[model samples]
Target: WYSTNLHWLDALRHVALNVTSVVTTTGFALGDYSLWGNFSLMLFFYLGFVGGCSGSTAGGIKIFRFQVAYILLKASLNQLIHPRAVIKQKYNGHRLDEDIVRSILTFSFFFAITICVMALLLSLLGVDWMTALTGAAGTVSGVGPGLGEVIGPSGNYATLPDAAKWILAGGMLLGRLEIITVLVLCMPAFWRH
Candidate 1:
């Protein structure tokens, strides 16, 4: 699924068309999940994290990368406990190299860390923890909006403090461009030999 394959994209598009029909009911309808209490809130959080597939307009960490990371980490752990055993990590029927596995894990970890740090910074700027955290995650993940009373779809970013707005704007840029693309451009090392 990580390949730049057209047929795979077509298959994904077909599935998306089907799922959109079931999950999305009416446009611009933001249900008041708070009425259902904490259960709805938790469910919404989980779904947001599960996210869309790679190459789609949808957000969150892509499925294929998750599969690759999982395989690599598990195999790595197994090797630690059983050095004599041989373990190979595979994705989409292709074996993954150590470098690719390392890169994916690095990206994923830094992505999560960035969200958390941004959220904490926003909170320091006077926003509540949940509002800042989910807002940071939602924007950084390109999932749009987030849970809680503020910055949710039911709410607007217009009222936020200027600093917070700028932070969220940066988060959107980071998400859309993907972290690696942004970091590479910013790095002094990237400019050198």
Candidate 2:
């Protein structure tokens, strides 16, 4: 891809910097390619979810969730191969209980659903579909720079309406709080304490 639009070294630098920033949830971009089709831009949106390690500043669903999902999938495949086999999922030397698996699944579901909902809201605010989707992903993952000309790495958020900014800010908070934490706070029982 770089061979088409940039010098080899420049492309390497941009790609490396972009990957590192997105993975770490910093979202700094050295270049902006709004002309890239959705197929390519969508990857960045999803990449926002592939955040860094547990203790790092990264803000997507986090690599931990992906690990659990992979383990669960492997366990399912193993079960398919041996219907009567007993299988347990483990991560980082810790045995994963059923509840933890369920929680991870639930969190992933909500994360995806919330991204869609946020995108919808942004579109209603007049943001284009591409911008809305990428913006929602970036904000929800706390990745910061979306795709597209207005919100891309080179684009700034200043052009967006105040309502859209507010929406993004709220989305960022949801991502930063891990969704579950904020949801738990919303529970009536939590307030009773």
Candidate 3:
């Protein structure tokens, strides 16, 4: 909206790039998108926290989990204020059961734990704290690009060690499967059943 572009193709191209950038969270760009400023970049970073549809390949904490958590959080705060208020968690006109709410909360907790663990792992590998943090975030989010100069947009991950790369690859798999799926298979009980 700042500059006037008469070409319709430019507008379409902009929209396409913007959507794909967040949808995949790979941070690909055809131009100087950094001009969008820190707020926009931060917004895009937050997008990686919001995954696409359940069946889609887009990874991160799926949108439904966020929705469930938001509803529950709202209900909790309302209860705090009203004390005797009977609050209900509803979405799309349907009430959420306890199991679904628990699952969402568990997933969110595990996701955050994974990020922190992975960041610690990277830092132990001699990576700077900033790189380690964003690298963990990107890998756990299943997003290839991260913050800082090394793994950020226009930077290749080749600088990382083989071990770090391998760890990050595992992180990607964990993220894609929502962590619990793969972790469950590692339990000794899986084979007994």
Candidate 4:
């Protein structure tokens, strides 16, 4: 489902010539996104880290889990509103337990916190705010490019110091692996079990 305007044009233009979609672009849409305004850029950056469906190669937290989290969170809030109400949250026509919901919430929290911490570290390395924010998001999401002048599609990471590069690489690996797997591996309890 992650398709493109070019693909849409190619698929539709042959069938309907009346549609007046005209554009001549040299590079990919990723580059086009990098060229968007700050608000649009930030949104894409968010979605980039909160990726496609589960089992897809695309990185970041999958959509279904986020939905489950939202539903559970809302249901929990509703319980406070009406103490005796019985509300059940369902995903994919199946019921989810408290443990599963808690796990998803914890994962999302850590994922966001990790990005912010990485961005702070990047800022300490003399990277500007936009670059740091988008860079952290892109790295953690495995999206490959950040916003702003240096790290955007028009630029490369070659100019960054070895330390910064290593930090970003670690973020990429952690994000791709999912935060829990790496954290669990780091814990002594995981080894004992």
Candidate 5:
């Protein structure tokens, strides 16, 4: 709840801006939303990972991946119930190939793992848990601001230790490039090709 007596329209606009900023990884903020309350903080934090649609420049895991995952889960549940029924996998009426499904799932897995590992490394560097976790998520999603006193909307990354900054920087690159691209580039076999 805001203490300022904002008009309902003004409040709606602010909420929309904050949500768009996080979901699109635009990094713009109208205010320090972390001060809004725990619920708003958590909502914005998670929105960073939802991201914009597929094929967009926005960084987190794209919306289509989640849609595919949901469809796959539903299909699996249906298969379990019907046992012998043939279930087709389709997205937007196009038949879904196994390779596409595999790639999406793999990317999602690596995205999460990368965030966790980075968070752990930040913690080891003496960053507090909230900062470490949200910082990692924010960076990996290519969302500029994190949720916390240190790197929240009102705060910048300038105060963070050099090592932590480097870690977050790496996360930003991986997120922008897409996790699989960087991971593949790291393989020795790829160089031999």
Candidate 6:
């Protein structure tokens, strides 16, 4: 929706750059995209969570997980339609084991839950809703700039409260290490082992 006053090619390039930057967790900005209106703001905010492809250094939920989830859903629906039919799951020409699918789905669930919980904690620290939610998402996804006036592309995190900063720091650690790794480390059983 940012096609006003600029050449269409320039606008397309800018938009593509921003999208690639966010998805790849590169954290570059040509301009304060938060000023591009509510729709673009929200769109960029969510794009942070899509992440890059599997095996890449980029954070957030990887694309393969979503593909596997879609495969699982499709197989499930097909099974429902024909109880006697056997469904074999495969991805990229390789047989998809139940364990791998379960792991991917579990990671996806925890990724979303961690973002929501972090957002709630930020809100409790008196941060505004947009800042809290987008900040949490951006940090956890390793996307540098968040939406909203305080932490948007033009704004820095120095203005945030100490507690909020600490929380976001934790989110960065979790995102970089992958949520499951940190969560496993936090368990008493892991320590005992």
Candidate 5 per-residue lDDT, tens place, 1-193, comes to: 3644678788788899999999999999997787778889888988999999989999899899999999999999999999999999899999899999999989999999999999999999999998999999999999999988899999988988999999999999999999999999999999995
Clashes of 4: 0
Tens digits of per-residue lDDT for model 2, 1-193: 5334777787777778877888788868766744545665677767788998877778988888888889988999999999999997789889998898889888989898889999999999999998898889899888988887888888878999999999989889999988888989989999885
What local distance difference test score does each model get?
0.70, 0.84, 0.77, 0.70, 0.92, 0.90
The Cα error of candidate 6 at residue 143, in Å, is 0.6
RMSD of 3: 2.9
Which of the two, 1 or 5, has more lDDT? 5
Q: Put down candidate 6 lDDT per residue, 1-193, tens digits, no spaces.
A: 3536678887788889999999999999877777678789878877898898999999889888878889999999999999999899899889899899879878988888989999999999999999999999999999989987899998989999999999999999999899999999999999884
Deviation in Å, model 4, residue 143 alpha carbon: 1.0
How well does candidate 6 score on lDDT at residue 19?
90
Candidate 1: tens digits of C-alpha lDDT, residues 88-167 = 77777888887887787888887888898899889999998888988888777766657677766477677779999899
Best by lDDT: 5
- Tell me which of candidates 3 and 5 scores higher on TM-score: 5
**Clashes (candidate 3):** 0
TM-score of each candidate structure, all chains considered together: 0.78, 0.90, 0.86, 0.79, 0.96, 0.93
Sequence-dependent TM-score of model 6: 0.93
Best by TM-score: 5
User: Which ten residues in a row are the worst by lDDT in model 6?
Assistant: 1-10
Count clashing residue pairs per candidate: 0, 0, 0, 0, 0, 0
Ranked by TM-score, the better of candidates 3 and 6 is: 6
lDDT of 6: 0.90
